[model samples]
Target: MREWINLPELGMIGLRAKIDTGASTSCLHASDIQPFQRDGEDWVRFTAHLGTLVQRRHRCEAPLVTVKNIKSSTGHVQSRYVIRTDMTLGDRMWPVEFTLTCRKTMRYRVLLGSKALVTGQLVVNPALTYVQDKPVLLDISGAP
Candidate 1:
């Protein structure tokens, strides 16, 4: 299922997503990823590129969740940085963990994997696209 989602905590909205039931973990497209410490806790900062034709870039920072080795569909395994953040789909909101990686070649910047679906109790119709309304962007001062 393809849908629009929101990362309110990240101040991102109306991001297109591929809700992949085959994927075990969700992922976000990111670049210039840098790890740093904040108040003695691990954190990560990166640039999240949005849109396909008219691209928009947003700088985001989140607390480090963990590093995990994920096997891609192309049979490549890589250690990726993970972060937990609130994701909004439809009218539901919940915390979802996402692996940050370079997905410039992908059609979607957000990949909603099986874990998110199960947690969100989402049932994909496969034939459906944009089943949920385009999420409203938060009126945040620094939102892009």
Candidate 2:
């Protein structure tokens, strides 16, 4: 199954994502990864590729959650940078953790793993793709 998702915190919208129940961690396509400290806190800056066909790029920075050693589908273990950000699917918004890596060779730029699906309380109907419409942004600033 697949869906269109939004990463508002990353300023990413309507990105195609493959819902992969087999994976335990979600992932995002990022390149030019650099780790640095900000105010003594671990942080990372990177360029996110919007799509495979186009060269559109988005520069983003976020607090580093951790560097995790993940075993890829190809059976290779690699350390990847992790970050927590808000994800929007349809009208629902929630915080999700993602491992940033280069996925230029993959068809989808984003991969929604089992953890994220469980956290979002999403039940995937394998027969459907893009079952949810594009997310509509909500104001949660508590100011009118």
Candidate 3:
């Protein structure tokens, strides 16, 4: 898998993602985050920024897995909401946990960390971008 990723479940495709081996967990940029209880389960509502050029926006909701204090690249620690979802890169698809926070100032909205890399499944070429063919945007009008 290349650095970029496709999150079909989240209505995101061909999205540029930063591969950070030093980080233990992945994270996604989200805005207007709101938490609520749904059917006795913790749920969160947020919006994801998709694509680079076109910059599409999608509203998403997921069950909150946990709250974690993540150290940012600048070494600042902040609490974020973690949610599990499937991420597709190349021909592989797997469940990954993504901490949700406002990353509006970051270069890329998605960050793929060590946990999502798995064991011996991916090789990162720091000098490369979009090693795999970009994914076509799927109709996620029905997605939740």
Candidate 4:
């Protein structure tokens, strides 16, 4: 069932995401991406503009997994930062890998790709948008 996703770890709640099976990995819209080392572990700092109104900006940091060369729909190749974070859809919540890049031009801020939409986990109805109950917005004041 295609459903809305909540990126609690990224301080983004109830964000509409397209469940695209054609895509290999999940993607998140991020900006001001900066890489840094924290006690020998790789980390990245980024900002996410939530909602279409851009009412709130969530400043977040996550351990960097790797940089991947991802070819976009327009056939442009770009390197993106990969980060692991938790996603909640329906009654289940699990960790998912997301490639961080600026998707300002895309319709949705988040894309739930095939990698995160495992078999038996969900079934997408191409005609539907947000099949699940909307989640409450969390306190993101301390996101940074």
Q: Highest lDDT, which number?
A: 1
Model 2 C-alpha lDDT per residue in residues 1-144, reported as the tens digit of each score: 889899988888778899999999999999999999999999999999886677689999999999999998899999999999999888788999999998988899899999999999998899889888765555688342
Candidate numbers sorted by lDDT from highest down: 1, 2, 4, 3
- Residue-wise lDDT of candidate 1 within 5-108, one digit each (tens)? 99989989889999899999999999999999999999999999999888999999999999999998899999999999999999899999999999999888
lDDT of 3 at 30: 90
**Pairs that clash in candidate 3:** none
Model 1: pairs clashing at backbone N, Cα or C within 3 Å: none
- TM-scores of the candidates are 0.94, 0.91, 0.86, 0.87
Supply the TM-score for candidate 1.
0.94
Off by over 4 Å in 4: 137-144
- Candidate 2 overall Cα lDDT vs. reference? 0.91
| RMSD of each candidate relative to the true structure | 2.8, 2.8, 3.7, 4.0
Model 4: per-residue Cα lDDT over 65-104, one tens digit each: 9999999788999999999999988778999999998888
Give the range of the ten consecutive residues with the poorest summed lDDT in model 2.
Answer: 135-144
Q: In model 3, state the lDDT of residue 115.
A: 84
Q: Candidate 1: minimum summed lDDT over ten consecutive residues — where?
A: 135-144
Write down the TM-score for model 4: 0.87
